[model samples]
Structure formats: C-alpha cells, structure tokens
Target chain A: MSMLKITDLNVYYGSIHAVKGVSFEVEEGEIVTLIGANGAGKSTTLNTVAGLLRPRSGSIEFEGKSLVGVPAHKMVSRGIALCPEGRRIFQDMTVRENLEMGAFTRTEEESLEMRKRVYESFPRLKERRTQAGGTLSGGEQQMLAMGRALMSKPKLMMLDEPSMGLAPILVQEIFDIIKELNAQGTTILLVEQNASMALSIANRAYVLETGRVSMSGDANELLHDERVRKAYLGG
Target chain B: MGFLTNLINGVSLGSVYAIIALGYTMVYGIAKMLNFAHGDVIMVGGYICFVCMNNLGLPVAVAILLSIVGCTCLGMVVERAAYKPLREAPSLAVLITAIGVSYFLQNSALLIWGADPKVFKSVVDLPSLKFFEGQLVVGPINIVTALTCVLIMVSLTLFTSRTKMGKAMRACSEDKGAAQLMGINVNTTISMVFAIGSGLAAIAGVLLCSTYPTLMPTTGSLPGIKAFTAAVIGGIGSIPGAALGGVLLGIIEIFAKAYIGTQLADAIVFGVLIVMLLIRPAGLLGKEIHEKV
Candidate 1:
C-alpha cells in the first residue's frame, strides 16, 4: 500500500497557480524524489502534502486516510513530517531544544528514545547540543534539521532541498545520511534542485517543470535520460 | 536616607513594570504584534479583583485567582476574535486593531465602572519594615511586590527554558511555519502565550492597585506605556531583556523624579530609551537578528 498518495493536486499563492494537477505516490519504505529547477513547484507539492499549503483542488492521502483539511500541526501525529526548505531551525533555541521540538507530539518515553536514536545517527548534534542553532555551520544546520525531523519518528519523512547550500563533501555526507535513514525503515520524499545527487539516491524520480510533472520513471533510467542530461545533468 | 528611600521606591515600581513588560514581550515575541489591549486587560483584572472582593465579598486569595483567570480568558478571547484573524495581515493593520481593542476595553470600562477613580482597599496589610535604624521606610506592600515579581520572573524563565510547551512557544516565535511543520499546534502555543502574559498582567494589576490604592479606567495606561518602553529598551523579543529593562527604567525614572524635575521624568525615561537604542539596538540580553537571504 502507498504511504502517501497526492492525486490531482492544485495549489496557488494568491491566484498564481504554483502546483497544477500534480500527482505522485510514495510506497512504504521507498525513497522517491522530485527534482526540478527553481519555480518548478517541488517545494509546493511537499508543503501541500505536509498540510502547510492548501490545495485548491485535489486530494492527499496518508495510509488511505484523506489529509485534505488536516492542519499542519496534526500531520506529525499521523506519521508524516516535513523538513521545510531553508532548514528553518529555531535560531534562538539550542540544538537540543530544536530536537526536542521535533517530538512535540510524542509521549515522554517515546521522545526520549527518539532523541537517543537521533543522537546516535548524528553524533555532532550531541557534541553541540547546547549551542544555539543559529551558530551552527551550514552543514551542521542541515544535519540538525534532518535530526530534528527524525525526532518525530515519522513513518514518512519529507525533506525539501536538504542540500541547497553546502560543500560538495557535506552534500555527499547528507545524501549518505538520507540513505541510512531510509535503510532504517523510514520512507523518504525528497525535493531537490540537485538533480544529479537526488537521482543517484532515489528509487524513483519525477521531473517537475513550470508547476507540472514533465517526466516520471525509475531513478536509474532517468539518471541516463538524454533530455534530463541536457537540462539537469550538465551534458 | 532620601537616596535609600528613593532606591526602594524605584525597585518597587520597577518590579511592577517588569511584570507588565513580560506580558508585552511575550505576546510580541509569539504573536509579533504589540497587544495594545494589554493595558486595558490589566485594568480589567483590577476591576475583576475589586468586584470579587468588594461586591461579591470573596477572600483576597480567591479574588486574585479569579482575576488572573479572568484576564487569561480575556487575552485568549482577544487573540481568537481580533488578532488570530489578523495573523496573516500586515503588522500595521494588526497594530491598529490592537489599538482599537484597547479603546474598546477602556470605553467599556468607563461605561460600566464610571470615570471616577475607585479606592482600592489594601490587599497586603503587612506592617512597614524599617531599615538603616528606621531612617529609611518601606512598606510591606513594597517588599511583597518586589518578592512576587522576582519569583514570577524566575519561574517564567524556567518555564520558557524548561517546559515542553515553553519550548514550542520559542519555536513559534522563531519561525511559525517551521514550528507548525514540527506538529506543534501554533495556535494553541500562541494562545498559551497570551494566557501566561495576561495572567502576569493580572498579578501586576493587583499589585499596582494595591500599591497606589486607586482603580480607574485608565489606570493601566501609563504603566503599560512604561512597560512597553521597558520591553523595547531590553529588546522587545527577549524575555530577560524585558525584566532588566523594566528594573532599569524604574530606577532611572525614580532617580530622575527625585533629583530632576518631576515633569522631566517621562522625558528622562524616553531619553534613556533613545540612548539605549543608539548604543545597542538589540537591548540588553537581546540577540541581534540578522535577516537570512
């Protein structure tokens, strides 16, 4: 069964249609990525799924339950978490506090267990646990953002542009962590502009252009596609 | 002796300002709007306590609790009815709405309680404490006020830094969208902020009236403005900043009134604000926010 299925979704920002009739599904334990350039509505689709953006017309379902009008804050309890674009970590809070906030909807015991797992996954977070989030380096912030999202222990984790700004090595490290998280039983929905790295790690890929999906295929096939190479892979 | 007395008076008054300033800072931090109705809520709290004590003949403890609860509900109602709808509205628009709410509260109080100042019976009837061989005089009300303010500030600090709900409040203040994504009910957190802030204002109101022994429709106005100034002086979004700013402003105002001209006290307070802004725009204990591109 599909973990998340967004069908015929249309989202707008003040009458400017941002995501038009976009539809996709993420099966259980799969890493599905949506890759596109800026203005391609990749973030919009993820945000809509996370209940942050209202879709003008369409349906979002998680585990076959309609998520059309469910509020954003309630999405986590339903087992879906979105690590938003720009790595919007709470700048004033300490790193540990940010992690704690990720488990905002969980019981004390569950949250504590999740915190330990997150610390084990990202040991650097434990080292700088008391440091303010704003003080962290870009790579550290990205790690914290992912770690924070993981604190919720969601069955489906949606990350938006986790590698938007980072060194090449850091980007590789982040992708590696993403792969590891996926291997540990959390299905992933990734939105990224880094088509090369995203396509490499994703099980399936969708190419969005101008608010619509232009292509969908197995990630390996799209990685070698001629048109994809010309537009996104620097052929 | 005069200096010592003035210092005590400053601390007492500053403590009151600190309590009210906490309301301003917390609401502003979480909601990003200056809740101008905050002062009127204080007035309402004062009136609630007055009615409970004088009209209904309740004990002081119950009266205080009822007033706090009343103000908490008022804050939540104001947020739900007025500010929540305007959450996405322009800051200026929300600000204007707050001003409108403030007027609504004041006018309603005026209509109900009359324009005449009502004498507030002394809630704290403890005897005065003498210091410096009885040269300096201090009332028990002053001591209680200072102690209460300190206790509240410390507890609030712990609350925001330690509790789960408090952590969510900080997150919401930082980035509302991100906080919501974390499955935090942003609306509930904001309402909690209003509840806590208004509850503090209620206590401040009771202490304020007890100190001055007068309750009027506009009783909360001057102190409210002063507390706002204190919030700005300490850094509007920083909790510790509010407390420090309140105490400093109180001391400065008191000293100015003692040595400087009485009319110049307000000017002095504002002048200090200007100086603080010019020297350190972030205020004491306030973090400098650099907008991310």
Candidate 2:
C-alpha cells in the first residue's frame, strides 16, 4: 500500500479552483517529484496534503487513514511534515526554538533526541542554534526550515520549493540531503521548478499543468521524453 | 520634600499602570488585537474582588484569586464570542466589535452594581514606611504594588522564555500558520493569551482600587486609557516598554497635578503622547516594522 494517497482532490481558493481532481501517491521510501510552472497548483497541492488548505472535494489518505479534515497542527503526530515554501522560519526565534516548535507534538525527551539527529543531518543549524533564525543566510535559513521539519521525525517529508532562492551549490547540497534522508527511510514528496535537478534525484515524477497532472512515469523516462524536453526541459 | 513625595506617589501609580499596560501589550502581541474591552475587564475584576470581600466576606488573598480566575474566564469568553469569529475579518471590524464589547461590559457593570460608588477597603495591611523622620512617607500599598508589578514582569519574562506553552505563545505571535504546522493548536494558544492578559487585569484592578479606595463601573476607563498610552509610549507590543511608558506617564501625571493645574494634568499627559508620536511614532521601544511597509 502507498504511504500517502490522494484521490480526485479538488481544492478551491474562493472562486478559483487551485487543484482540480488531482490524484497522486507517494510510496514508502521513494522520492516523488511534482514539477510544474508558476501557479500550476504545486504549492496548493502540497499545502492541501499538509492540511493547510481544505479541499472542496476529495479524499486524502495517509497510511490508509483519511486526512480529509485534519487540522494542520495535528498532522505532525500523523507522521507527515511540510517544509513550506519560502522557508517560513520564525524570525525572532532562535534556531533551536524553531526546531523545538517543529517537534512540539513530541515529548521533551523525543524533541531533544531528534535535535541530535537533525544536527547530524544538517550540522549548519547546530552551529547557529543559539542565534535567531532571521540572522541566518538564505541557504542556512532553508537548512533550518528543513531541519526543523525533521525534528518531528516524520515518516514522510514534503518539501515545497526548497531551492527557490538559493545558489546552485546550495541547491545541489539541499538535493543531496533530500536524497540522503530518503535513503534513511523517509519518503519524499518534492515540488520544484528546477525540473532537471528534481528529476535527477526523484524515483518517479509527475508533470502538472494548470492544476491537473499532465504526465507521470519513472523519473528517468520523463527526463528523456521528447514532449517533456520541449515543454519543461527548456528545449 | 514635596518632590520626593510626588516621586513616591508617581511610582506607586505608575506601577498599577505598568501592570495594566503589560496586559495590553501582551494581548496585542500574541493576538494582534487592541482589545478595547480589556479596561472593562479590569472594571469587572475590581467588582468581583469587591463582591468577594464585601459581600461574601472572603479573605483578601482568596478574593484576589477568585477575581483573577473570573477575569481569565471572562477574557476567554470575550475572545470566543466577539473576537474569534472575526479572525478572518478586517482589523477595523474587530476594532468596532471590541468597542461594542467594552460598552457592553460597562453597561452590565452599571446595571448590576448600580450608579453608587463603593468605598474599597485596602487589601494591603502592612504599616507605612517612614524616612527622614516621618517627613517622607510611603504607604504599604505603594511598596506592595511596586513589588508585585516587578514580580509579575520577571515571572512573565521567564514564563515566555522557559516554558513550552510560553514558547508556543511566542511562536504563535511570530507566525500563526507556521506555528500551527508545527503541531500547535493556534486557537488554544491565542485563548491562553487572553486568559493571561485578563488575569493581569484583575491584579491591576485590585491594585488601582487598593490605592484609590473607590469602586465604580467607569473606574477602569481613565486608568485603562492611561495604561494604553503608556504601552504606546513604551512601544505597544514590547513588554519592558510598557513598564517604562507606565512609569513615565505616572510620573508626568503626578508632577502635572502637583505643580501645574489639576485640570490640566490629563491634557499635559495626552500632549506628551502627541509629541512622542510626532517624534517617534513607533513608541520608545517598538521596532520599526511599522515603517512604511
């Protein structure tokens, strides 16, 4: 069974339908990527899955349990976490505080234990744990956001545009961490505009256009597809 | 000698303002609402403590505690009934609703307690402190108010920094949506802030009444406005700023009353606010986040 599944998801932002009948799945221990253009509902879909936005009609199943109406705060305990777009780290809070808030659903001991693991995964955050999150550089802030999500020890981690405002080297480093975390058993659902880099690391890929899935296949197959190359691969 | 006396009185009055200002600043910080009814909540707290002591004949400590709990519940209810539903509404709408709630509390108090003013008995029983051969005098209530205000400030600082719930409050203040995604019940955190802010209002009410020895439905309005001015002077959402603004306003008010004409004291106090705003619109300690964003 898939670790996460959504069937016929229809989400609306007022009169605008953001995600129309979008169905997708992320199996355990696999890296799945959703590549799309601007305003194609990639972020909206990820947000709906993370429970930030309620779908007007659809079913969201996580580990075979329905997540249709679960409030966003309760999603952490259900073994899912979203590293939101734009790295929404608390500016006034210290890095450690940011991570503590991420692990808020867990016990103090578990939070502390997970802190150690997150530090192991992203050592940069540990160095600046005492500093406020806003003081960090762009790359460091992204790392902090990702590290914070990992503090929950989520079974499935969804990242939304993690590489949007980072340097090429930083983007490569972040993708490496994503691949490494997947190797360590956390399923990954990634959304990115950098289709080439995303597809290179993803086990499978889905192309979304105007709120609907345009194509889905093994990442490498789509990477070499003639139509995929012309449209998204900058032909 | 006269200056010294006024300074002591100023500090005492300032301390009460500090307590109320703290509450104002905190609710503004976490919930981002002006909570105009906060002063009315103070009026309610004063009435509760008065009833508990005068009618029920409860001890002063228990009376104060009951007042705190009552105000806390009232604060939460006010949030749920008036503020929560309008969470997505424009802030102006919320502001209007707050003003309506304020009037509601005031009228309710008037109906329940009547228009007659009650003489409040001082809760503090300690002897007055004397210095300079009794030429300099400080009431026990003065000392107690200052001490209690200090204690509350220290505890509040520690609570927000050290405890998990406190951290949650800080997180909610920063970004509610992000905080929720971190597994925090945003509504619960906001409600807790209201509870705390209202609890502080009880203490402020008691302190104000203890010092003045009068109880009326409209008693909290003047001091409430003054404390809000103090909060603004210090920087509305900044904690220590509230204390500073409260003490400054208190000192200024006392000096104006003692030296200048008594009727002009309030005018002078408000004049200072206008001047402060003209010079530093962000208040003394408020960050420039409001700068033309």
Candidate 3:
C-alpha cells in the first residue's frame, strides 16, 4: 500500500517555480529514490512533502489524509520525518540533546524506548552522546542527523542528500545503513545526487529534472536504461 | 564598612540586572532579534504589579504572580503581533520595529500613568540585618533579591538543560527550519522563549522597584540598556555569560558611582564593554561561531 502519495504538486520560491506539478508515491516498506543533478528540484520536492515549503497547488496524502496547509512540525506527529539537506543538527547542543529533540512530539516513555533503539542502530552515537554536535566529524554528524530523525519513530522517513560531502567509504556505510533501515520496516524516500549508489538500493526511482519528474520506473531497469546512463551515470 | 556596603549594594543591584539580562539573552538567542521593547516589558510588569497590589488590593504574592502572567502574555503578544509578521524581513527592519514597540510601550505608559514618577511601596517589609558586631549592615531586600536571582539562575539552567521544551528551544535557536522538520513546533517554541524571558523581566521589575521605589514610564529604560550591555559583555547568546556580564556591569557601575564621578559611571560601563569587545568579540562566555560558507 502507498504510505505517502503526492499528486500534481507545485512549489514556488518567490517568482521561481521550484517544483512544478511533480507527482510521486512511496509505497510502504519500499525504498524509493529521487535522483537528479544540481538545480533539478529533487530537494524542493522532498521539502514540499515534508511540509517545509507550501505547494502552490497539489495534494499530499499521508495514510489517505490530505496534508495541504499542514505545518512542518505537525508532519512528524503524522509519522513523516525529514532529515533535511546539509544535516542541520544543532551544533551547540550535545549529541543526546539532538536526538532528544527528534522525540519532541513523543512522550517520555516512547522517547526512552526510541533512544535505546537509535543507540543500538548507531553505536557511535551512543559513545559520543555527551559530546557537542558541532564537534562531530562530517560522517558522525550525518549519522546523528539520521539517528535524530529515527528518534521520531517515523513510518516514512525522507532523507535528502545523505551522502553529500562524505568520503567514499563513509558514503558506502551510509547507504548500507539506509538499506538496513529499509529492511527493518521504515519506508524510505531518498533524494540523492549520487545516482549510481541511490539506484542500487532503491526499489523504484524517479528522475527529477528542472522542476519535474522526467522519468521513472523500477530501480533496476533505470540503472541499465541508456537514457539514464547517458544523462546521470556519466557514461 | 563602606566598602562592604558598596559590595553588597553592587551584588543586589547586579542580581536585578542579571535577571533582566537573561530575558535579553534568551530572546536574542532563540528569535535572533534584540527585543528593544524588553525594557518596556519590565516597566509594564512594574505597573501591573502596582495596579494589582494597590488598586485591586491583592496579596503581594498573588500580585507578583499576576505580574509574571501579564508580562508573559505581553511578550507572546508582542512576538506574534510585531515580530512574527517580520520573521523573514531584514534584521534592521526587525530592530526598527522593536524600537517602535519600545516607544509605543513607553508612550502608552506615559498616557496612562502620567510622566511624573510615583513612589512605589516596598512589598517586602523585613528589617535590616547586621553582622560583624553591628559594623556591617544588610537590608532584607538585598538578601532576598540576591538569593532570588541565584535561585532563578539555577532553575533556568536546569530548565534549559533538562526539559524537553528546553531542548526544543535550543534546537530552534540553532536552526528553525531543522527544528520544524524534527516535528518541534517552531512557533510555539518561539512563544515559549518570549514567555520565559518576559516572566524573568517581571520578577526583575518587582525586585528593582522594591529597592529603588519609583514607578515611571521610563523606569526600565536605563536598567534595560545596562542589562543589554551585560548580555553582550557576558555573551549575548550564552546564559551564564549574561549572568556574569550583569554582575560585572553592576559592580563596575557601583564602583564607578562611588569612586569615579557619578557622571562617568555610564561612560565607564560602555568603555568596559568596548575594551571587552575589542579583546573578545564573541563576549566572555559565548562560543565563537565559524560561519559555514
């Protein structure tokens, strides 16, 4: 069943139409990926779904309920969490505090359980729980960002550019974590500039270009597609 | 004996400034706006307490509690009405609007209460305390004010460090967009910051009026500026920095008034700020922020 469905979404930043009539769906327990080059509106689409940006016109239905005009904070309570682009973790706060912030909508008992689960998934986070977030290495920060999002116990977790600026090995590790998370029952909607790695793990893929979804299909088919190879795979 | 008296007086006054400075620091930290009207909130708090205690004939404790509630609401109202609409506007625009609010509050007080200063009756009626074979003396107000400030500082520290709402506040201060994405209500968090800041201002107001015993439209102006300076001195966004700055500013102002001429006291305070800024631009307790390109 489709957990999140977006239909004919249009988003604007000032006069520029950033996401123009984009539509997509994330099925339950499937890893869906949006891949594109810079300025392709992939982030914009993700943000719109997360309710960070209001669409000019579109229908966003999460669990069959319309999400138009819903505030960004309310999205989390609705079981949708976005790990925003650039891993915007609170630098001044401790790692534990950042994770705690992720459980803002949750009760104390639920938060404690979530914290234990997050710690289990990312042992490094458990080790560095007392350290300030800003002091963490880029890879650790990325992990913390994802871990922080996980603290919400989201059904549909949206990750934007999770591998940006990381070493190849760290990037591989992040993808592994992503795949592991998907296998563990979190429905994932990923936005990425690393088309090759993203397509490898995704069940389905959508190619966003200049503010619209230009191509989409089974991830495996798109990986071997000549058009995708020529445009995104640097062939 | 005179030195001891001056030390006690400085600490008592400094504690009041510290309380007020907490308001400035917290509001600036979370909202990223210097609420120029914060000082006026102090005046309004004083007025509210006055009306409740004198006009309404409520108990002192009840009057003080009502003043806090009044200020907290006022702070939230000010944020929603004046600041929220201009959230995305330029900092200068917000600053100007804050100044406008400050003037509006001052003028409103002037129109309602008149320009003439009225004597404020002391709420705490405890007799003075003596120590060291009656050589050293202390007013009950001084002890109460100092202890209250310390208690408040500790409680605020615990609140910001331990509570979920406090963590949300810290997150909001760091990144509003990110905080919202985390399912933390950014609007509610901002309102909470305003409420906390204004509540602190109300307490400072009552303590200040108790000592100084004067009520006027501009009652909070000087102390407000001093508290702002204190916040900047300690570190505008750092909580401990604000407290430290307030105490240092208080001591400096008191010493200047005693030894250096009264006219040069303000000058000395500003001069100290200048020197401190020159030495450490981030203020004393403020963490140095590296701008990410």
User: Largest DockQ belongs to which candidate?
Assistant: 1
lDDT of 2 by residue, A1-235 (tens): 9999989999999999989899999999999999989999999999999899999998999999999899999999999999999999999999999999989999999999999999999888989999999899999999999999998999999999999889999999999999999999999999999999999999999999999999999999999999999988998
Per-residue CA lDDT of model 3 for B133-234, tens digit only, reads 899999999889889888888888898899888878888888999999888888888999999999999999999999999999999988999899999999
Q: How are the candidates ranked when ordered by lDDT, highest leading?
A: 2, 3, 1
DockQ score for candidate 2:
0.89
By lDDT, the better pick of 2 and 3 is 2
Q: Model 3, range A63-114, lDDT digits (tens) per residue?
A: 9999989999899999988998999999989999999999988999998999
lDDT of 1 at A165: 87
Candidate 2 or 3, higher TM-score? 2
- Cα lDDT tens digits for candidate 2, B171-193: 99989889988999999999999
Lowest lDDT sum, 10 consecutive residues, model 2 chain A, at: A18-27
TM-score of 2: 0.98
Report the C-alpha lDDT of model 1 over A99-190, residue by residue, as the tens digit. 99999988989889999999999999999999999899999999999999999999999999999889999999999999999999999999
Measured against the native two-chain assembly using Cα atoms, what DockQ does each of the candidate structures obtain, in the order listed?
0.92, 0.89, 0.90
